[model samples]
Target: MPRLSTRTRLLLITTFPLLVLFVTLTWYSHQSRQEEVRAELAERGQLLAAALASSGEASLMGGQFDELKASIYGMMQGDSAIKRVTLLDASRKPLVDVEARTSGQPEARYFEAPIHKRLLYVTGGGDRNVGTMGYVQVRMSATALLAKQRRRFYIELGVASLGLLLCLSLAYRMTDGFAASLKSSMQALRAADEEKRRLLQRVNTAVEDERKSIALEIHDELNATLIAVRLEAQQITALAAQAQPAPLAGQIGDKARAITRLALGLYNSGRSLVRRLRPEVLDMLGLQGALEEMVNQYERNHPDCHFALQAQGDFAGLDGNVAISAYRIVQEALSNIVKHARARNATVALLRRDGRLEIAVADDGVGFDPAHTAEGIGIAGMKERVQALGGRFAIATANGTRIAISLPLES
Candidate 1:
């Protein structure tokens, strides 16, 4: 599964708590509104009852019960909400039922109205006699008040929902903005990594080019001069053998031959140094040609040992880095063979197969334990050169020393 971006994760973490709070607040507000509505209805009912009771009490005390009954009847007619008003004796017997048509009607007759569902307040008042003066009861319909409260509750719910939606939208936008920023930063880091790899490759190429230049100078200039000096010394030795006193001639010949030997040694050392610095044939004759030249040189120097070169496929237009690394690895392997392998025969092979270039240098030599021997600078340098070209290096000595290098066909 793909991963969630950091901003999205953070937003979820932030929004979850907010959502919980919103739900909690909404629940609390809804409950409060319900209680307030109920309390408001009860208060309004109490006020109506109190006013009716006061009017009835004053009327009864003033000995004007009939007038009071008429006034309540008139009041009921003016306000439909006042379903009924009544005066009852202390024994709970009706003295007057204003909603009834007859003045002498019992209070139980007023209970016929559906307003009795509200259970409006009832108060008792009467004289201390065989029959009490009366009590008063008043009721008003609660439907309209209940409807208003319900409507308010619905409105509050809608507002809360809208507010929640807005909050979520804002959170989503912020999360998206943060995610975009993070993506851009990641892209920049990837680009930087690619550029760094390219720079390292260019540096390796420049260093290899300089090595080739120095090798050419040594082989073409220094080695040529040494060869000339050796030829002149040989001529001097031949001329001295032709004309000189007996003992003096012998001494002159020995000195001239010694000079020639020294000059030849210098020339060989210079040639070896040039090849070690960089093989000129790698650039002039290509990878295969370079391998062959190295094998021939090694064979000439170690006449007792056998050397061979083989090629399996065309290597034209191979990447320069691949060619250079392959050549250097083979060269180093052969040098090791001559200096330490004590080999009687060595084979160098170059092949292209399955979109890969493979180079192998093997020798039938007294191979040393690879684990016991320290990785000298030569092997490390060869490995680094191969890695710079994106290649792999391996060494095996089960039967004899064998070094193999492989590089991708494309750089």
Candidate 2:
């Protein structure tokens, strides 16, 4: 099953139980209403039976059939709900039966009561009950009663249904509002992230450009001056060699040689600085050639540590930004391995597959815990550079340190 969003989950969680409760309450209400109607009908029927029995007492005892019939008819006319009236003698035999026939069986309520007569003395002081005269049976139609109950039930059900809908709608609206707010927050975060990436990209580009400019200035001005100074020192040393005073010539020649050595050291240091700022080979030979040269230099500098480079693909088509980022990533990785990774050999692989360039640098080194160690400027710069070009940077230190990057060729 597909996962549900917060809104959907909230809707189901809130509404399902309410739906079950609504159904249960409705059923319960219907049952209670039915029972109430039945009870009311039964009570009404009993009261009607009692009233008829009281009114028809004298007629029943006197055997006045016409009078009893008149009384029953009058009562029936007064209330249309009285469906049938049956008067019976002491033995349960019908004396006078008057029925208002209805269409259905067990469709109306029925009630019966006994009729009794009391004896009076000649002195006008009334006495007690003497005999049982007869009984009265009344059948009451419940159609009107049932109709009213149904209307009431319908009204209650409608109100309940409306309430349920209102509650559910409110819940839905609340969840939807929450979800909208959450979505807005997420969009804002993404926008901020995009802006941060753009800013970092611009910074990296400016810094690289400055480094290149400074390298060119140093190479053109400072290195040229040092070369000129070195040539003059050598020419002075050659001229001083033919001087007549042996000690003076030896001292001057030694001084000139010393000056030339100092100038030579300064020139070499300047050149090394230029290379550190920006390697010209990167521009001349492309990313692959630059990486090979860098690896050779690293091996030379760290004689104990072995370095190897393997390259495959048309790196010529790679974008400049992507190439630089890849180069820098590899450069930083190797530097870290040399500084921290206490191991012998490192491997650098550059491959292009499916329109993207992949670079992996791994070393058989004592890997350090990434969580415990903070990344220095070099590692951080490499990460920022890769992200600036819309690429991925991943590093793992378990087993051995590995840094992997993938960049789109077009980008």
Best-fitting candidate, scored by lDDT: 2
Task: Return the clash pairs for model 2, or none.
Answer: none
Give the TM-score of each candidate: 0.44, 0.61
Residue 323 lDDT in candidate 1: 77
Q: Model 1, range 43-132, lDDT digits (tens) per residue?
A: 655565566665665566566778887777777666444556766655567666656333222222222211111123346643332323
Query: What RMSD does each model have against the real structure?
Result: 16.1, 11.0
Local accuracy by lDDT, each model: 0.73, 0.85
Tell how far residue 55 is off in model 1, in angstroms.
73
